[model samples]
Target: MSVGKLPVIDLTPMRAGDEFHKRALGDALREACVHTGFFYVAGHGVPQALIDRVFAASKAFFDQPMADKRKVDKALSAANRGYEFLGGQTLEPGAPPDLKEGFYIGEELAEDDPRVLAGAFNMGPNQWPAGVPDFAPVMMEYYGALLELSREIMAALALSLELPEDYFEAFCTEPLATLRLLHYPPQPAQPLPGEKGCGAHTDFGGVTILLLDDKPGLQVWDALNERWLDAQPIPGTFVVNLGDMIARWTNDRYRSTLHRVINTSGAERYSVPFFYSGAPQHEVRCLPGCLGEGEQPKYAPVTVEGHLREMYRRTYV
Candidate 1:
């Protein structure tokens, strides 16, 4: 079956017991990954109510006055959690700061946890805003749901690569995951030439699952056509995309396409993107069968922690 610029995949067959259906779904996923590295997922089984609650919580938190939101400034957290005001992040060096404010959350770890005790980067407790009483609970619930969904999707991706469905299981224990809530305020009618809600860049982790409101701001770079294509929002679906780590693992067979947000709709936009990665100590080497005869691996093996730390340093100003 021919797919459009972006395909919408139903994940129901992945949960079915029949091997035939599962393989078919895997084949579809492989096609999408090789071609675009981006797709919309439906029938993912995440409760709509949970999604709504998370969005409501995000709105409530971002709606607070600037002074109130600044109390949990991300600059104060060693783990990069908490609120990041506008101009705090610059995805592309030398570019203007992204015109968005965000709140970052990660798995909560106690001060004495082994990872925390070892001073592992990005493995620590998150800073929650005092103003939004329900934000922490709602976001934590949503994060757990997305993490489960990511596991299922990872299994499908493994099958697509002709690997065992559980091939990634070992690497996922104590994974490094983050849920980012972003708010882009309305832009002027005629803005500066280079101003954008977000600069063009690819994600640094294994995969990103994004929940977007009804808006037309996201755009994906069409490398083949040398044009930008709108990744318009579709109700009840999450926009799933491959990240740099996955592309490296696949030996460049799969793309980690560049994407950016520009809120030209003149309205506020909110999105939640969950980034999932393997355990920090796991080294990402080119996968078996990803290379053919005489094909060379394009990247050297790197530990998840090292790569992520470098990326965070470059992007988070």
Candidate 2:
């Protein structure tokens, strides 16, 4: 039923535009979401050539001189779009900072865009590193592809919950998604206690679409089993995981599992994660189906932007 602990779902059936098969795909998605909150997506329609190009660009950008990378440091951008040096983020409280350097890209907006004019959180143009001249275009192309795929996955999620297929249409419009390229060096021979490539934390958004390099490091917390399970990288598949907002939306009927990376492969590792957080103004509330007859909502209503700001405050503070 599953590749390992996580399900391997093929989107090809749904891509055929068959209503019957689409609902069948939704059923499988519901199982994976409720059980593991993680899965591998195959036949997602992104060209392998494009995927390869994006990886090449990521490595090239990260391979640039540290001074060059710092020229586009995330601190320099108001919207938090740029390079983040290793150990810059502490995802798990009390643990050592994550040992990964990353670059963030989001919807390319102009200085005069209304969202930018209003000074919305994380709204503005991206700051690209000029050292890797082709990085921006390659990353943007991959971003565009993932955006389309994210919406399709959202629609399928709606069907999974027995909602109208367009239930999340508004949320997908003008989304506050982010595409992050991360590079993790091999783990230290004598690592600090609790140190990891990425600290254990649940994602903050709607859904995350991740492309991983062949080196192993990813681990998903198995709450029921009370152990960490390796999420091995599979060729031709992207790892997909639900985020905290989805758990909030579903009243926790679906999980937002904790996951981290611990690159022990003795080689460099690179991964690209696209966070599909939905629209800034979209209000997230418990779905009717997610609650029992007398169950109360576990969380209060919050807009996407508000939730993200709160999550960022907790992790970055």
Give the per-residue lDDT of model 1 (tens digit) for 238-294.
999999899988999999999888887888999999999879989999999999999
Whole-model lDDT values for every prediction: 0.89, 0.92
Instruction: Look at candidate 2 and give me any clashing residue pairs.
Output: none
Span of 10 residues, lowest total lDDT, candidate 2: 1-10
**lDDT of model 2 at residue 74?**
90
- Residue 22, candidate 2: C-alpha displacement in angstroms: 1.4
lDDT (tens digit, per residue) of candidate 2 on 1-317: 11256899888875786888888999999999999999999989999999999999999999999999999999999999999999999888899999999999999999999989999989899998877778888889899999999998998899899999899999999999999999999999999999999999999999999999999899999888688889999999999999999999999999999999999999999999999999999999998699998889999999999999999887667
* lDDT of candidate model 1 versus the reference: 0.89
Clashes of each: 0, 0
